[model samples]
Target: MADAPQTMVIVGGGLAGAKAAETLRAEGFTGRVILLAEEREHPYERPPLSKGYLAGNSAREKVFVHDPTWYAANDVELHLGVTVDRIDRQAREVHLADDGVLGWSRLLLATGASPRTLDVPGAELGGIHYLRRLPDADRLRATLRTLGRENGTLLVVGAGWIGLEVAAAARAYGAEVTVVEPMATPLAVALGPELGRFFAQLHQDHGVRFHFGASVTSFEGQDGMVLAAHTDDGEEFPAHAVVVGIGAAPNTGLAAAAGLELATGPGEGGGVAVDGSLRTSDPLIHAAGDVASAEHPLFGRRFRVEHWANALNGGPAAARAMLGQEVVYDRVPYFFSDQYELGMEYSGYAAPGDYARVVLRGDAGRREFIAFWQADDGRVLAAMNVNIWDVTAPLQALIRSRRPVDPDRLADPGVPLTEL
Candidate 1:
């Protein structure tokens, strides 16, 4: 049995760590709670960094997870702008970059992910930005405005969620956007080529040019500023500014240095490995958010979801588990995105080969529809509602049921989703 919790320390100041701190106090744990944040800013959510905040639709203050005073008000020690150098797991202590030491009975590592950059030439040039933090968004937002005013082109690398969102935001600001992807369609890996083509069409309709089936060979720059991007096909796309949205890699350095067990499999998001309760190999240590690859009870496999919903929910779940409460973290993976006029909520997990086909319930041409990725036997693996609202619960329920449904009725607009 776990010892009575005493001092609890949480590393990483993102939404996961913040929510974990909140949940610890709400659970009536009287132990001292110390939250160590590497970033100088208070805990904040990152979705807006790519969407609203990037578009200037959401204020900077709106991204924070809690008010500045809330940490102190709840007796939770908040250490901002502090870096944890190493974890002395044997001593149950965390050593700070400043040489400070903090003893803890339980520890949580919510060290979120970092934006992955291109390895090609001129990748380090100025005017090339990657969006992952508040400051990144701040810089990109300013660059977009400048590009928009000058009628310049914003070159986007990769056709993933971040790239597409940035493309949409760039267009909204009246700047030209050109997306270069090695894949044939945007979001092909996540949404499949069919829906991926749909997204490609959406952006193409808005004047965003796409160079599909191409990869960036090098970035052309002058005097440390990027000028354009050269593709593998020898095509050159002029770029006043470039945004690299290849992907993000989980910040697992600290945990790995501590000798904690980590997931090594491909596509597992490469994070600290945890069980259903978010407990790592070491009983006294746990990890959540983008840093954790948790064994899900429902899916019967380890999954490290980097979406905002995972961080928002994983932190609290790990906290309850840390408190020795009966806990099972098996939330269906979820994420949302807003690009141009398209708003979408995706629930459940269905990779390319996992699902046999996609079933559509509404008109795809009109861009108001629900798409379901199902198994060969018609079991719902994942569902996405585009320009749809208030159906998350039912969609999640269908995924949880794990039972096959008639594809014909599933594709019928007359059939209620709850019936599935």
Candidate 2:
């Protein structure tokens, strides 16, 4: 019999893939590990692309997760700019786009997502952009620097995190920013209507115009440069540049083509199905980050969360599960967005039609408040706070520990979160 294979192959060098390799080494695997990255550069942090990086406040080197020496010294073979085109499950081989094949004893799929496209007319026009990879941010930064503040009329479509962050950056550059969203409020699906409204107000206060409940019907342009956008309400507005941030669809075509079981339904969003332990139907394969639909113990359902926290925490959890120890990948779903003068942070999980009661702590008028979502059983389901970081740690612990707190006490700002 052949000796058991010792090589491990990791596809996609995003945060999840890099962390998995680091975790494996930390666990004393000491085997041959290969990390395949489609990008030429090493794995770098992405959250800043839409924020500090876009504003040119963060240098490129500062965004990288680790130095090149770390990967070299750790004996991780990094394949930069090499795309994995096919996975042969039976053969235990990954076929690269460059006509190369890598054999492995175990495989991990950390292929992150790409930005969802706008199917509307004039999408191919110039002066239109989408923020995802490092290259995308570079293009946006160039545009911002060239346009400066006076001539900068940025039309941002969608009110998700990326869109909002870009808007914040544009406004900070003294650009006139306008955001269009089909929903009643920005981030309604994620932050709920009430908190979403607060976010809308926050942006409006920073001189950003928001077209709530508005959809872009088409874009009108000449010479491949977008000039204006027509709305479904029969309105037109001039725009110098356009950004589409409608959200993202998981890059799961490779997994789906390999016959991996995918979670289907409204919230799955085209992602691979994984159990509580973040294991796919094929035990040899594991997934993390935005591409993996993981089961949440607190929410009691499977969902895909596209957030920096999810990628940072879920990556390690999936790595642990892949190492033969079954571990529940449960972390209070957390996300933060810095836009204008307000810093928004949220913890726990909240789905549509889930919150039975919402308790407000602190003063919203003063721009410091905490909104708690409670289930019908009066248990806290999720919480959002504006400039209130003190409540997050306790609330996160409560959600993870499944501890019920008194709703009345939670509603009072004077009562310390520890009282729960």
Candidate 3:
């Protein structure tokens, strides 16, 4: 007798979930596949939410990962606007909020994450937004269109990528923007202190105000809209609207309840713990995207990276591993940001004590340069390029291969990176 068809059930409908589904089809898996998404819309690209989408440069229709026809043609089942409330690991079943249980041979949890909210007075008031979904961007875009930018003050909380991107969008619309960060400089945690200082200066040059080492204590609202916010330093600033881009907490409650090991390390929070194969402790289950804290070969650490490239790259890697053809997740981590007229690109890994030399190419004063981090053994550990892209690709290849290059040669702008 023939064996029963394999059934693969995927939870979440973000980039990771969508990419996994596409990969399964591409691998010629003719099994029964189901995708469950809580959001009503199709899976879409999220990076644009803070930039082009906010600036009206890209339309909502253009952001979809794959059109409806593609999914239909692939025989993949999509359960849109439905939430998966529980996971029954024993039965390999997923309990849906809409009164249904999905049985599966293999389960992939790509539940993704939600924006972290600030615990402050009047935070529930209107005119305060968080940009994570399309609806959030739509609402903010409408406000920008109606208020005409210059007519309002935009207060942004946190100096992370999302906050900085939103600040850039608001400033582009001609609004007066102020960013409040408890750290001494923007992106301090991710880029370290020196690069963080450069980021702070980058934004300051574009007319964005930075309130460093200041924390928001309370929010003041009038007529259902936020009017001002009080800081820890006993100071208050008036605002027309507020945006909180502090960070995100992974959607891992269901996975934890199902007895899957979750990430608990320093940078890992609310994300599932996965092995090098991207498989959870329970081999029957797998995790990916922002919800999976898989081991990073380059950094010698395990942490969740909230980046578009990771979602696109890691999703397929996890899917391939799930299919029993294991692939090493060793790609160099890469991410980019666009704020004002500056375009910054980061490639490779930078961990404490991993680098012994910091080489600079181009002019830091002109805000167009590349900083290469090199280990004492002479391997390129990481590279941060601001408005400089010509040399990044070759440097990225060398970093991934763990190739050694002379530090002085790397700093020479006139010399080719390949020669190093």
Candidate 4:
């Protein structure tokens, strides 16, 4: 095969994988492109899984990044339900689960992440679910429909994004919803305590129950089905079905098995370590999306973001880096969520204890607001806009500029974000 152009193999058929393949072709790569997907479906987005899709407001086919014909039209081989068992870096090959081997000139890891599981006695029960994939969402949707709005209880194990979104959707279907968060406030690490409390109130106002600072000791079930959740505080929350959305664990097993670099120790999010350009330790290998804890020159830190924006953009950046292009995976991290009637967008990075102040431009109770986090020096650390539109560009600039601005000016509705 010396006469043939080099082949590029990409693992993980998700948003990142789809974008990488698209970028390679758009950038004029004439070589063979192969996408190995563990799921039977085509590359799709997971954001809608808990909201529109699970709530029955969205069509299933709309979640996919591309239809079946797109891959074949682009001359990309899309292999469904195939797993890469090992990465032979020395041989520049990947061993498949079916005992097949594939040689590659370059490899991209877009393995994404898996939902973190709860370790409890009755966790394996039939009425328990996690929402990370389409199938998971489908099952949850079916259960919610069967329970009906007047029927059973939906006990959510966490108040993170997925958990909160699922709670909202379940509530919309008229199911009784209760969220249990070990943290006193929901999304505290991202939005800080005050805003997290605001979300707690928002959910409560809509009739969602909360058990803050409580840990689930175990789930109680009958005949291999979860019936109730018992808390460490000796409280029992009865449920017809339970959905756990604690968080996600990056899918880095294959990379770890291949002795690839991982982000370990202080401030490093756990995932495969990659340089600014998304190139892994091996020159021929790269990683992107949820699986890559990549360094960002702009943020001056490494982060593993599991949002749609990161995957939508990170995939292209990794593909360009795989082509030996001088690039930086330095886009301002962004993500958004919709619950009930509230729609919010957040940009920039903020770690726990990273910012010293929080300023608001509108009423938190009114649900029309822009919240900004600033360091002691007044440099904007992060910004979130709820029920706001067309302000993300300016909001992103405010964060990227790193300019020290007066808190008064930031909170004043008359002063535009860009002017600040």
Q: Estimate each model's TM-score.
A: 0.98, 0.96, 0.96, 0.98
lDDT against the true structure, each candidate: 0.93, 0.85, 0.86, 0.92
Off by over 4 Å in 3: 351-357, 376-378, 390-392
lDDT of 2 by residue, 54-73 (tens): 98888988878789889999
Candidate 3 scores a C-alpha RMSD against the true structure in Å of: 1.7
lDDT of 4 by residue, 296-401 (tens): 8988888788899999999999999888899987899999999999999999988888889899999887899999989999999899999989999999998889
Candidate 2 lDDT score at position 40 = 93
Better of 2 and 4 by TM-score: 4
By TM-score rank, best first, the candidates go 4, 1, 2, 3
Q: Which residue pairs collide, candidate 3?
A: none
Displacement of residue 238 (Cα, Å) in model 4 is 0.4
lDDT of 1 by residue, 1-420 (tens): 975759999999999999999999999999899999999999999999989999989899999999999999999999999999999999999999899999999999999998887999988999999888899899999999998899999999999999999999999999999999999999998899979999999999999999999999999999999999999999999899999999889899999999999999865768999999999999999999998999988777787899999999999999999989989998999999999889999999987788898999999999999999999888899999999899999999999999999999999999999888
TM-score of 1: 0.98
Best by lDDT: 1
Q: What is the C-alpha RMSD of each candidate to the true structure, in Å?
A: 1.6, 1.6, 1.7, 1.2
Mind giving the per-residue lDDT tens digits that candidate 3 earns over 1-420? Answer: 998999989898999889999999999888988999899999987998888889778888988999878888899899899988899988889999888988999899998889999988889999989999989999998876655545788899999999999888887788888999999999877777778888888888888899999999999998898999999998898999889999999989999889899889775555999888889999989998889888877667887877888889888888888789867887777888888778988888775555686788889998888888888888888898889777667878878778788777888888877776
Ranked by lDDT, the better of candidates 1 and 4 is: 1
